[model samples]
Target: MTHWRKRYHFLVQITAFSLVLYSCDVTKPYANKQTVPDHLYGDAAADANANMAVLSWKEIFKDPLLQDLIAEGIENNLDLKTAAANLKAAEANFVQSKQAFLPSLSGNASAGAYHPSDAQASNTQVYQLYALSSWQADIWGKLRSTKRSMYASYLASEAYQQAVKTQLVANIAVTYYQLLAYDEQLNIVQQSLEVYSKDTETMKILKNSDVVTGAAVVQSAANYYAVKSTVPDIKNNIRQAENTMSLLLGRTPGPVKRDSLFNEQVYSELSTGLPVQLLANRPDVKQAELQLRSYFEQVNVAETSFYPALTITGQAGLYGTQLKNFFSAGAFLANIVGGLTQPIFNNGLNKQKLKIAQANYEASEYNYSKVLLTAGQEVSNALYQYQMVDEKAQSRQEQIANLEKAVHFTKELLKYTSDTNYTDVLTSEQSLLSARQSAITDKLQQLQAVVNLYAALGGGWK
Candidate 1:
């Protein structure tokens, strides 16, 4: 009884010490950056709250076909599905962690026949049954830390799924527009071929009348064929871009119907909210932060491992020499045990775990910082691109106008000219063709910049 009492007092004192250690949490809560930029873009943004990142996918991508494609991607994308599955598993683990401190109960039954060596020994049957229970006390907050870590992991997986979703939406929009641009280019080239053929006929008439030489007519025909030769390549590129869109929609490679490139309007309200918003809006950044959170909790768990563990175990059951007397009072049996295990030394295993956990926590912090910097850089790049293309689009329109007039004037001059060289007409036509193609590229760039801005601001997931 004295020995038992002393052990009881020792356990009580140990429990008190454990309470003290629990309060001294080695891992601290994560802190935000000391100086987060006010706006993602370098310059001041008016009404930062009026950002397009708040807009939903339906609002940003106004094209009906694109909206439908985004819907299909959210529904059928394999990466999102995988992330969701991982989230489910994490949830299960978290729930299990919540129950870790609770005792476990189990039952068992056994029968045995044994004989002792003697002149006339006989076998006797012994039957036993037991209800066993055990529990571990989480005095050092180990189980709670596990629960916290698991919950963080579950949230991280959810963020990963959202990241995948945002990426898919952006991909579908970009590919659809690329296909449209290719379609427009094909039309432009075909129209140029028609003009070239007409010019070739005029050149032939001039040659017959001795106004131009046969070499001029031949040169005109060659230029017309040169423009015509580009048609097949443009058609192939358009087909491939369409196929890319089809795959994004989780369908077999095929055609994707869309509005003409000229007809598609840019996303409305290209506001790039505050840079601080990236913590919540950018799923990759959010996931990285949550990963930091999980590792932080793991540090606490590792720190707790250096302490002692308290456990209580018990077994109560019925046993007898014969089944007929199993219910007798003598057959009733019960036993209980309590234990404390302090890891004095184990080849530095606990220290190693602590080291690993601290290193991982630090790594997570670094990764989170990198994600923030990357988000800011991308937003800045998109904003600059948007401004550049927006300005160039106006210039492109003016250039297109002047080049049209040049083509018209050069054709008239060639029709009645007594100039030494007819090369000016050919040169003007070539310039016009190049300018028209560049104009198309400018418009496409303007539209593409909008898509990139939306993504950089984390616009699609919502």
Candidate 2:
């Protein structure tokens, strides 16, 4: 028996040696692949630190109402809640992965009775109690790499949660602002309708007194009806906007109370810190980078699988035929085992798995790059939109001023001249009303552009 044991040991050593040689031939497909660039913004020519994005949510949105809504969204929004739960789940997985590197200990106990039915046979009772332990020696760094991969995944989930929070805050703010803008537009339309109705009444009196023709009265009445028709449509829009805001707040559709749109203050000078800081500041970008890092660790784990895994196991137990004898020292039993397993053949499954891991790693790298590029594009687009809206607001404000003057002058001219064509008056009124509505829309655009810019720069949810 001793000679046979020695021969078995020798064979095990030879097998281990052969596995090491085989491992030397196995290599990762992405082992030589270069890491993806950390920054995709192409704006790296500036001061390395100058492009960093920074804006606390409080500072970015100074409005108390908006800040309150954002806070509510963080607390109650279902998407954000799901994201938080996912982060917790990832953290739990990371803990389990880390535990793989430690030894596992367990205890066991058993009690039973046995009896024999024969001439001169006697009944026997036995009891047993013991403990067991096992641990894998991660000499190949497989467990360490797996734990690190899980840690990276945990961090990625956290980043994803942050990204969700950022989006939630931005969406709530934008929707709330939209509702306010609709309110302002509705008010403007109502006021325009009131003015037109009064003008229609005055034109009717003039026609009855023969100061204006029946055709003039009809034109003025048509203008009044046109302005009045817009009121119900604007009201419907306002209600829809309110419903949208309610849904974003994670509540049933209902009324949304807000401050006047004109009263809302938006920052005039939007200083977008820099482009290079997006990698660290943008939650989506950070999430992608973490996913890439996780994949990198996965590649290491895959490479380590080509090497042999050493595991040690032990089992100790106490057994007794009599239940009360389970605690007795005579009932104690124990065992210990150690093994080294190296993949010899599995129908090419291991190799295929490695290839799949390599493909996933490459895909993660591409996704990271894509995320960075998309973030940069969004920031650039938002900045340009903010600038365009800022310019448009200025131009529209001037246009509104001119239209106001035209309305006043046309009204005055109508009062002084008996031959003043009511058609001309109606034309001027409609143009002025159109210009005023455009100005209100431009104001909303300017505000929304600010919201978009802040979101793109990853400024909110800080």
Candidate 3:
């Protein structure tokens, strides 16, 4: 009895010690210590609360056909689907983690006959039935930390899904605009072909009248063929762009329907808002932050492992040699035991676990920082590109006007006098065509800039 009392006192002391440690709170709650500096968008950013990312994709990509394509991509894009699946899996893991705090119970029954080898020995029947339960006390908040970690992972998965969705919307819109630009370029090239044909005929008449040499006539024809040869390459580019959009929509390669580049309009004001808003807007940024939070909890879990674990196990059963007496009070048995385990030595495994967890948490912090910087870079680049393209619009039109006049003036000079030649006409005409094409490209750049900025601001997923 004295020995038993000593053992009981020892158990009480251990329990008291563990409870004291528990009161100290070995796990810390998650906190955001990350900071974002000023001027993430450089000097060009408009300091406003109204971010374009807050708008729905429909508001940004006002084109009806482009909106339809973005909708289709959200519904069918395989990467988005995969992200959704990952979210479901993370949710399941979080649910399972919550269940870890509950006790586990199991039941079992068995029957057997036992007999001696001697002939005179009588056979005996044995029967037993039992139920067992076990539970581990979370004296160090280990289970709580694990649950929080899983919840963070689930949130990260959700952010990942949204990131995929935003990217898909941007891809669909960008590719659709590219197709439009290609169509316009093709139209411009075809128009040039007709004009070149007329100029070639004019050159032939001039050569016949002795106004120009054979060299001039051949040069005019050669210029026409050169412009015509670009047709196939442009068509091929259009086909490839269509296929790219088709892939984004998770469909077979085919032609994509789109309005003319000049007809598409984005009415949303291009306000970039504050750079600090990236934490809430950018899905990838949010995901990285959540991942860091998860790792923080994991480190807490690892720290808890170095402490003691308390578990309780209980069993209740009925046993009897005879079936009729199995239910009697005399055959009833029950027992319960509480145990405490403290790791004394394990080849430094516990220390190793803590070190590994700490390293991972630190690594996640670095990765999170990198993601923030990248987000800022994207916002800055998109805004700068839009500004540059917007500024070039008036100059581009003026340049095209000048080139057009040059082409016309050169043609008349070749017909009237020897002051200019066919080479001069060809050069001006080519310059005019190039300027027109560049104008179309400038429009494309402006459209893509808006799309990219919207995406960079974490738009479209809402």
Which has the greatest lDDT? 3
lDDT of 3 by residue, 286-389 (tens): 99999999999999999998888888777889999999999998898776677889989989988998999899999999999999989888998998899899
Instruction: Write one digit per residue (lDDT tens) for candidate 2, span 18-137.
Output: 446434433333232333344433442224443324767777677888888787777788898899899999999999998997789977656556787887459887565677888777
The reply for model 2, stretches above 4 Å from the true place, is: 1-53, 116-123, 319-332, 415-420
Q: Residue pairs in steric clash, candidate 3?
A: none
Model 3 sits at a Cα RMSD from the real structure of 3.2
Better of 1 and 2 by lDDT: 1
Candidate RMSDs in order:
3.2, 4.8, 3.2
How well does candidate 3 match the true structure in TM-score terms? 0.93
Error of 1 at 242 (Å): 1.7
Rank list by lDDT: 3, 1, 2
Better model by TM-score: candidate 1 vs candidate 3: 3
Query: Which sections of candidate 1 miss by over 4 Å?
Result: 1-35, 44-46, 119-122, 420-422
Q: Write down the lDDT of every candidate, Cα atoms only.
A: 0.81, 0.75, 0.89
In model 2, how large is the Cα lDDT of residue 307? 78
